[model samples]
Target: MRAADPALDSLQGLALGDAFGDRWFSVPIDELSDALAVRTLRPAPWPWTDDTAMALVLVRHLITWGEVRQDALAGDFAAEYGREYHRDYGPAMHRVLRGIGSGGDWRAITSSQFEGHGSYGNGAAMRVAPLGAWFADDLDETVRQAELQALTTHFHPEAVAGAVAVALAAALAVRTRGRRAPGRAELLTEIAGRLPDSEVRSGLRIAARMPDRTSVRHAAAVLGSGLLISAPDTVPFALWSAAGHLDSLPEAIWHTVAGGGDTDTTCAIAAGVVAARTGLADVPPAWLAAREELPDWVAEVSTSS
Candidate 1:
């Protein structure tokens, strides 16, 4: 039998974590608080949101083409969003995908979002981890591919930075396989070296300085966790959680959830990175079973590849 693809493993971890984290969105504040206090998860059949949807599209494209071809990726993203319109896409993303589906120029549509300032949202970062693992042998290539992919829907520097950061984290995780997990300082140094000057980079630097024993609430207070849905607000905390919990996939995801902002995306990013190192063996069977199956095309590609 063929060995499982590491990239596919990362994607499964990402999608499952995305779905698992999403379950918290519907819980009452009191109930959520109680669950968190005990580190308990919500019920099963956890449905994923746009984070998994978009990541699957990217994974499918990679399996078919071996690299991100910008034009084809744009089309695939549009087609995926159009088919899965109920996945809670953000308004800005909806506009971009709709335009792309209608044959509008992807570059123009992406650059024109948010009144021409483009988007600084976490959308780009949410779906990019597998790309990192795919190019893990080449950190430079991972950053380049991550930027190209992010530019399809997000043109803002911060958004691109967030994508690059997550990609680097995943690549680093893959690189650390069978070795000791990277320390926070090592991970941050590598990521910061690749990232350009941006709020996301600054936030990651802050994350590096955060003590290991810091509580999630304290960490979240110092580093925002997507409460504003911006790259700067999310990537730092997600990376911090992933680095701290590289040995425990469930704990990494739980830390992301405990941070309490844009839970699904944060957990998705964190889980993807840690899973590159730990795979799904450490993830709870119940959580994996609860996630919706990945897109059929993604499964077909993985099987046939």
Candidate 2:
């Protein structure tokens, strides 16, 4: 189990998860509609969705700044986002970005969301795996930087919790790649210690108890899937998938998408963390070919960084 380059591994994982999860929408109706019943992927080109796009934004920020600069990242997010205009942007996030586009203060826009609690959406969790991989050698710093990045728009506790879980998961995966991968107990303990008290933490505690469920179908039932799309609901499913399939990026992502809720994000989180440790060697070549092409800036940033 030789470790791969963290950046390359993380990038591939994020891309694969994004592309695989995007199958629900990009695939033919017959294929997607039948995926749940079959529990098998059709041989098709995977086209990633918003999850990959936002992730590229974060990777670009890290490559350019070396650390997350709140203002700069926020501006980059606003610019890169809203381009599709039809992608599934959360209502609160959409409002925040719209405000930024209209010359409103980023802080003001974020602060005004969710009745001043700010957004607790899984948006932060969706894109944070790369940050964790970037700081894998330093778990504490991984949590710190994840917080700095998440606060750009997601100021709520659950959002922060979700980001923390993803960051710590990425760090654990990278740190343990060459050795035995962390088991569910160790993984959860590390993440729980880094995170403060929250429902997300509680859900993780629950996830650690169900490691052998070995199926996203069962895990999501216990973990609430991502239909709620909050940190508690979404993060647990990702953690469960990551823990159960720690060494297999494709299987982890498959489990996530199989959960049937917030497929892109759950898969993104699972892919990002697992891939950081396992690398792209395990990803199907066809899936990579099918994914949306990375932006030139995103590529330049990851490579240069």
Give the count of colliding residue pairs in each prediction: 0, 0
Instruction: For model 2, give the 10-residue run with minimal summed lDDT.
Output: 1-10
Error of 1 at 75 (Å): 0.6
Judged by lDDT, which candidate is best? 1
State the lDDT of candidate 1 residue by residue for 63-173, as single tens digits: 778889999999999999999989989999999999999999999999998889799999999999989999998989999999999999999999999999999999899
| Span of ten consecutive residues with least summed lDDT in model 1 | 1-10
Provide the TM-score for each candidate, comma-separated.
0.95, 0.90
Best prediction by TM-score = 1
lDDT of each: 0.88, 0.79
Summarize candidate 2's per-residue lDDT along 208-274 as a digit string, tens digits.
8774745666777888767887878899888778877788887787767777777777888899988
Clashing pairs in 2: none
